[model samples]
Target: MSKQRVLTHIDAAGRPVMVDVSGKAVTARQALAECRVRFPADVAAQLRKSGLRSAKGGIVDAAVIAGTMAVKRTHDLIPFCHPLPIDGIRIAIDWHGERELRIDCMVKTTHRTGVEMEALTGATVAALTVYDMCKALSHAIVIGPAKLVGKRGGKRDVGRVV
Candidate 1:
């Protein structure tokens, strides 16, 4: 018989609770998350014409910096996330199409818990930063499906090749 997968963030009393990782062994962990921003066609044309820059400055460059900061501060933003020393964080922003911007955030740590939340937060915030910077051009920008694309270490690895 297969065992049922129990929710890790819940207590025996059925209350929401943070998972305890104190007894778990520390190991190298990495997670990758992504978000996509879709801008209006005219806005994209203007951005490309400007070499992907806006009056505020380079859009992709600013997103990378904001994503890195989000990775380091994830625990502060999410109540259940454990504070871990991030060994490294890399954020890449690229164009998926003429009107779509893709943001990927990768985070690494040596900790008992995985850094999936950190990676997700990083990507989401970076996408938000892009929207904030480009709002002046149009209010029709769309952001997300923000998601964890990969994760490694802890009990199991998930998504793409680790």
Candidate 2:
């Protein structure tokens, strides 16, 4: 039989609570997360022809800026996240195929807790920003499959993309 996994953000009474990291050893940690935005077929062609610019501005640049900002404020957005003094944040946006754009966010910090949440939040927000900027072009755009590509530190290291 496998071991039962315990949730760290709940008390014995099952009330939602932030996980305590005060007693944990401080360590250098990092995480990478990704989200994708899929444009409609016609929209992709137009975007490519226009060098990824829209009426709002440069689509990729706006996403990168929004993603970096979100990474720094993840604690304020998420109920259980600890405020981390981030060491670095990187957001990359690029075409994955013919009609889909991929966003990757990587966060680094030296702290008692991990930064996977920060990475996830950043990537997701970035993808959303893209959708918002391009909504005028089409309402058929889709964003999804957000996931943690990798993380390091805490109880154990997970995945490996970063």
List the RMSD of every prediction in angstroms: 1.2, 0.9
- Among the numbered candidates, top TM-score falls to 2
True lDDT of residue 80, candidate 2: 88
Superposed Cα deviation of residue 117, candidate 1 (Å): 0.3
lDDT per residue (tens digit) for residues 49-89 in model 2: 98999999999999999999999999999998999999999
Number of the predicted model whose lDDT against the real structure is largest: 2
Model 1 lowest lDDT segment of ten: 153-162
The count of residue-pair clashes in candidate 1 stands at 0
RMSD of 2: 0.9
| Tens-digit lDDT string for candidate 1 (83-162) | 98999998888889889999889899999999999999999999999998899999999999999999999888999723
Candidate 1 root-mean-square deviation in Å: 1.2
TM-score of each: 0.96, 0.97
lDDT of 2 at 29: 95
lDDT of each: 0.91, 0.94
